[model samples]
Target: MTEIRWLEAFVAVAEELHFGRAALRLHTSQSPLSQTIRKLENDLGTRLFERNTRSVALTSAGHALLPRAYRVLQDMRLAREAALAEVEGVRGKILIGFSGAVNHLTLPPLTRAVRRRHPDIELDLTSRVRTRDGLASVANGTLDLAFVGVAESPDPSVVARLVAREEIGAVLPLDHPLAREKSIPLQSLAGDDFISPPTDGSSSMTEVLLASCMAAGFRPRIVQELSDPYMVLTFVAAGVGVTLMSSGISSIIPSGATYVPLDAPHHYMNHAIAWSADNDSAVLKAVLDVVEEVFPPVAS
Candidate 1:
């Protein structure tokens, strides 16, 4: 039978890189630690370490197994905690974070679904922040989960699940000639200054927008770096510059601005739920289960 201790041992040794230190950390002796690791390697048919009297190092297979070991331990911890919380009749609180981009569409239904399913689980939603901030909070355990707008997760400790995808369009001043068209070629705005949300890893939309522009043969000259989505639109409305935005948010467009679909095909702004890989809170699992029920993740 498979045992969790084997993974725990592997992780401890992989992190410490010295069997003596790892054994000390695990409150066990070096001989037993070496035996456990050897058994693990035999079962897996791979040498996890290359060792000598002077030094010990991870083999390529060991490096590969490290992350998987962390994930397994984390999952086990979550299962155990969740089961205990249930047995103890503990009602838990979960803190949720959201980026401005996902606030309109994703949060409302998700909140309703969570409430409907896990009424005993308290959900505390944070104010609108950027995807980067939400991701950072989740990774640090300050928030349990977050709905964010990003193409990919920036941190290894944080995981992102795609929950929504929407067509992207140009946010232009109402009087801009291109705004009159039903669809605008992205390159048409090549020479125009842009008002964009911060591209400093705060939002994944910034990456999508920049990539789209580069593909269209021009780099956007951003005049402002507002972190707020509405603020970016406000600047575009005031003729500061134009920007790329999700078409689903066109309803919130300020009166002075218009959203025109980009002629580019299949490009979209993505929304994802992010959480710490190590978070073992039962409340978090409950909320995540609700997310899975209400909004199945987009197939990769």
Candidate 2:
């Protein structure tokens, strides 16, 4: 019978794609790791890896087994944690994925709450641009939760709970004429140079800004496109151009920039917390409860 030890060794080697590195991660020598992997392959009667002098890669069989093996390992880990929690009355880790913008507005408070409420629960946070990708990570058991924008409906496999909402606005140089207006009409800035966020099919802000401009009957003359909102605002403060932004971002506005709200009917953005529907960990549930208490959903 193939031992659990061999399965773990195979997984480590498959993930690292190198025997030496896999051995390092496993805290064992390369020779034993290699021997265990060979034994696993022999027991399974198939080659799991394609090895060469320069590189190592998973064979077709290995690729097919990877996801299943990962799930087994995850289940075992959860089981161990459950056993420990039963003995000590607390324990486990929750992985959180988020976007850059969400980090500024939501993550700090949520993390503080988690730390205060459940210090025994380890929290791991990662940043990513695409909310969909984050949701997928949760679905695949990679992430326990995610902080995402509520611009679109999420997948059925994931459950999203609204966290916060704020009005969208334009950021301009302090000296710009539009900065004088308390609320600027989107049409008023026609013909003005604009700096748009990059088109990565991830930033809902990009689509919202473009659509707002189109609704106002003008295609913005985009002079620059950037990935980071702070960078775009910096460019605006330098008089490079004007850019649309959310009120949550006002905290990061550069010294020379002023944020002005947009007029009625076109000025709001929603933020949400997402997690896998299948995940029912106490830590994730506790975090969700705190988020809901802090940022209740708004009716659209």
Q: What is the C-alpha RMSD of each candidate to the true structure, in Å?
A: 10.5, 4.6
lDDT of each: 0.82, 0.79
Q: List where candidate 1 sits over 4 angstroms from the true fold.
A: 1-90, 150-155
Q: What's the distance in Å from true for residue 127, model 2?
A: 2.2
Superposition error at 87 for model 2 (Å): 1.7
Q: After superposition, how far is residue 99 of candidate 1 from its true place, in Å?
A: 1.1
| Candidate 1 local lDDT, 89-198, one digit each (tens) | 53567788876643688888988887787677677877766777888777756577888775455678798888888888899999898888989899889999998878
Error of 1 at 207 (Å): 1.1
Which window of 10 residues has the lowest lDDT sum in candidate 2? 148-157
Please give the lDDT score at residue 162 for candidate 2: 72
lDDT of model 2 at position 258: 89
| Candidate 2 segments exceeding 4 Å error | 1-70, 151-154, 221-224
Per-residue lDDT value at 150 in model 1: 59
Q: What's the number of clashes in each of the models?
A: 0, 0
